[model samples]
Target: MTPEEKYELFDRFCSNELSATEKETLTKLIRENESIAKELKLYQELNSHLDTRFTSEKEEEALENNLKAIGNSHFNRKATTKETKMIRMPAWAYAAAASVAIIFGVYFFGQSSPTYNDFANIPELSITERGNTEKNSKNAEYAFNSKDYAEAEKHLLILLSKDKNNTEYQFYYGLSLLEQDKYVATTRVFEKLYQGNSGYKYKALWFEALNQLKQKKYDQCAALLKNIPEDAEDYLRAQELLKKM
Candidate 1:
């Protein structure tokens, strides 16, 4: 119902003639809008004034009824004015509304999306390139390249146990953890790699950014991406991702 209809119900309530539905609607409006509650209080006081000041019961009743009708008429006029304002909205109006809604949805969902899968370009780890011919290193390489992250993480752990300072092993191990959604472990490994001065410094920053992206930490991701210099391998990709964000 319109505000006019609601005011009509409120007037009927003041006149001691509220139906069950009008009472419920009035109660709900009072709970929902403080303005309605204040207005209702004033309306009740006006009714009280009509009852107390008038000596003749019939005269009091007629005056109260007219006052209530005037209140109803005032709100009805406002409702009529509102009705006049609402013409048929165009198709483009709906399209514009949809576009606004889509933009709104993106402003929200974009905070969560354009994620790790959207930008991760993790290269296949090669144990032979670093001259580690150990069985576990070979296993880690094969498993990681084949996207078997669970097995890769297990084998990389064994390899890292023997050679703790091998940054290549650590970077790939971080990748394995990240691929398996081991976010905390991935960040730990990547943090060490990023902090150290090695071939993996910028690379570590890039992957850490991807790790942040996976967790929907766009600000952190952007921070890490910005640290990548133009000469860095992932610099172009990071800039592109920033634009999307």
Candidate 2:
């Protein structure tokens, strides 16, 4: 589906306005398409943030009361000697004005460019099945999964030293560098991986795009994301990110 259509569906879904068939379709998409699921997750999160930031029942109530008071005061005012007239704005008009302001605030917030954190869904590192049984391997897995990138980097470096050609080590090592903002080192690792024939090729490309995204390099990120073919694991995610771009 086109981005516009997908987003429109998202809006309708969030508003609980979807018909039975549309709801079914959306449910199937979310279940079968990882990228759509992630997109919907992000969409819901953005809506929640907008609601929390812009909408307050108490504030709306106060504004409505204030508008009522102002209207009543204007109506009660004595007419001038020349019999000048005044028009009191309707209560709904005041509410509509407040709604417009909030809508504009949400519009501008939505218009802001997407960030790396918005798209980076890093997979958990697990090398225990590889039967390495090495301390550094275990430590790297633990640190990376726990989001301790510094510790992860240290262990990953040691692991890579012992197994320089291990793509799994290299991939997670690249991720560690990325989390630590070692942009130059991160891209170098990913570049090499994507250029190779390993299973990490497209995966590396995806993260490389995210690396570019972190640095706000829109053109380069878009180019990298477009290089991800349809059969790649991250193709759907790449398409979603491209739409945001």
Candidate 3:
């Protein structure tokens, strides 16, 4: 489609004005064309930002009236001074200005502080493969994977009691506590794991950093994230998050 037609379709999609057939077509295009998908994502972000920033209808109406008044005054002055025919500003000029505002707004909005959910890529809990055939292990696995952190925490506590030195259990138990906002317990569990030599050492550090992030302790979070080494699995993600901070 032509650029103008594509943008019109984007506008309609944002406004929820697309018919079912048009929606299907747009979905297919988004799947097949990376550029279309990226553009649509930006369009959605811009629309959401605009909606939040200009929530009052009265405010929007006042802004539009002011723009029209300014346009008319400028054209009327030119007509009187130069003896030239007054040319009214087209309605599309207002729309173009709004579009520019949307672009700049999205840019600045993107620069805002990041949240915990933006970086918390929670891995699935799977403890059954390591010769753990207990019922509590199975329940813990299921509950944690299902995102029932409270239930997972209960089962994990029982599992850890039976196998206290299991770093896997300790690490995931920390995650469960973090999910439940038990910050003190969460850090206690992760502190032991990261202080020891185990596969979960760096992983514990990462999650602890995320816990600090959730609590809005940026300094503590950044300190923990800095401890994650270059060879660690979450190193790149930690670096990215540090840049945002």
Candidate 4:
């Protein structure tokens, strides 16, 4: 297809007005041309920007009208006997203005949606010693290593409740659950640790992938194992698991 034809097809695709043949033609052009790919991205962004701009404008107009009416109520009494110049707007103007003001406040002031700052201000918890005793930690670790999950779980739960942010607590809590054959709980704990930007990120992911394998969730297990960083401790094991999968 000619450049003009490709451009027209892309526009149609962006507007969702294209037929199957046109979509196929455009897709083929984009695959064969880097310029078309760039143009398609630009068009998508422009379409979104135009939508926001118009919505913001409508909001501003509504807000202005509401404020004008609130100012005119007292003035209208005197103006009623005199030559009146003020006009009344619908109460919906107030709602529109509020919506616009909020939208602008968010767009220009870098104000995020409620959830944007939700996690930001959440206080970080320090990992504390469960009983400030090395023996407890050692015993817990030993129980865990020996696959005596029941004893390990009891100790680990106590440690975790006391110092929830502790990496050791998180790891062992997950491990104990795994040993107890609590596959779903084990998966949830490990998945959280793995996906988080915490210190135990890769470790949790690696271990969770293993837990997935044990549960015979082969596809999910493979995907998670593949994401393990090469520098991570379990990278080699993950690779081995992938091959076995």
Candidate 5:
């Protein structure tokens, strides 16, 4: 997309004027293009600065000066706090860009299973004791990040055998199975996590939803996504994916 087109989408996003489909498309576009991401970040920061540009007190002078400084860094045009009118845009939460479309094609335009590439942001492995450099830990970290799920599963099993109560190991083990399309094994792992009281309980539900989504089981996916409360870290992304699905 052209810079102008991207800015238009960015404006619509700030104003909450885009449809859910448009939002998803714009989001995917921004993620796939670094230039667009940078542009959007600059726009949001500019919008945030402009929101506080006009203030009436002497202490407000610092804020106004800060806005000028930001504009100097990010904008090509000149700006003064004394400018008579302020540009206003509707404010909304900026959905994080850490979300990647793991699927091959954008879901906004098609009726296909979401892929592991689009949604999963596998956490970095720091499984062993901080001072320990075990072979299983090193191998698991490398295998998982390299998308070698089979290798990851082998090492993870070794790690889990030694640390049976490690929920983090169990969690990544499930993800490894899921990535390898071991649906039955993956379900077993996540189901155990979902039933336990670990910090990963809610996250297990989110991953199960992704599992269902990858299988095109929209009803099951929707149900799992709905079970996630607003306080969960994945809640916002779950809602966005739910809408697209």
Candidate 6:
């Protein structure tokens, strides 16, 4: 099978939804390709992390109830004949509960999501490209790319919690933190991403340089800018920043 096809199957396998034959085929594919095998390992690790981080049934129930309330607002209540049981909660209560639930869900879920924001749609880096195989990456990317920083933060955090070793997610999580103006945390994340050899390596360096520039650390900014690869995607930006530094 092709690499992408194998990746799709691998993801299904991770989700435990692949058919027996598909699983067998994936097993065969992994046997033949070392890169696929490595990807599978990373996917497995991320799945394990998710299982650990967001395993609360109560939180899940609250979120479900909130969603149900939001969708049921238009439904008319049926009068019961037995004892005339009355549903008394106002639509506003449902709305308020759902809002609270959504906030909790976003924060807890983001803390555990598998793809963080700092790396959301970073030019050349796909979650898969950066060794992140989380199922939530796309959703997180959508939220982040659309500038819904709050929603984006939720999924990204969840993803990162699942794959802390992934520099891409860490980078994106950092960017999300930065977007929210969490400068110190953003600096730390970009520092890690900048130091790594992943696709975000140069991008992180550029961001770190930008962060330094923002803080008036001109010498540090220039130093970081100096390290951005001449052929890196952000080369021009680095040069521009350097001139200003």
TM-score of candidate 6 to 2 decimals? 0.44
lDDT scores in order: 0.88, 0.91, 0.92, 0.72, 0.81, 0.72
Tens-digit lDDT track of model 1 for 181-240 = 899999999999999999999999999999998898889989999999999998999998
Task: Choose the strongest candidate by lDDT.
Answer: 3
- TM-score: which candidate is best? 3
What are the RMSDs of all candidates, in order?
Answer: 17.4, 31.2, 28.9, 25.6, 29.4, 32.5
Residues 164-189 of candidate 5 have per-residue lDDT tens digits of 88999999999999988888888899
* Comparing 1 and 2 on TM-score, the stronger one: 2
Tens digits of per-residue lDDT, candidate 2, 171-241, equal 99999999988999999999999999999999999999999999999999999999999999999989988
| Residue-wise C-alpha lDDT for candidate 6, range 46-94, written one tens digit per residue | 8788886679767988989998997676343432332345556788988
Q: Give all TM-scores, in the order shown.
A: 0.55, 0.59, 0.60, 0.44, 0.53, 0.44
lDDT of 3 by residue, 54-151 (tens): 79778888989999999999999887977633555589977998999999998767657778898998899998988979999999999999999999
What is the per-residue lDDT of model 4 for residues 50-141, given as tens digits with 9 covering 90 to 100? Answer: 98888799798899999899779867867795653355658898799899998998775542221212111111222334555555566676
Off by over 4 Å in 2: 1-104
Give the TM-score ranking, best first: 3, 2, 1, 5, 4, 6
Q: Can you give the lDDT of residue 110 in candidate 1?
A: 61
lDDT of the structure predicted as candidate 1: 0.88
Looking at model 4, report the run of 10 residues with the lowest lDDT sum: 114-123
Q: Candidate 5: where is the Cα deviation over 4 Å? A: 1-116
- Stretches of candidate 4 off by over 4 Å are 1-135
Q: After superposition, how far is residue 165 of candidate 5 from its true place, in Å?
A: 1.5
**How many pairs of residues in model 4 come into backbone collision?**
1
Model 3 spans with C-alpha error above 4 angstroms: 1-90, 96-100, 103-107
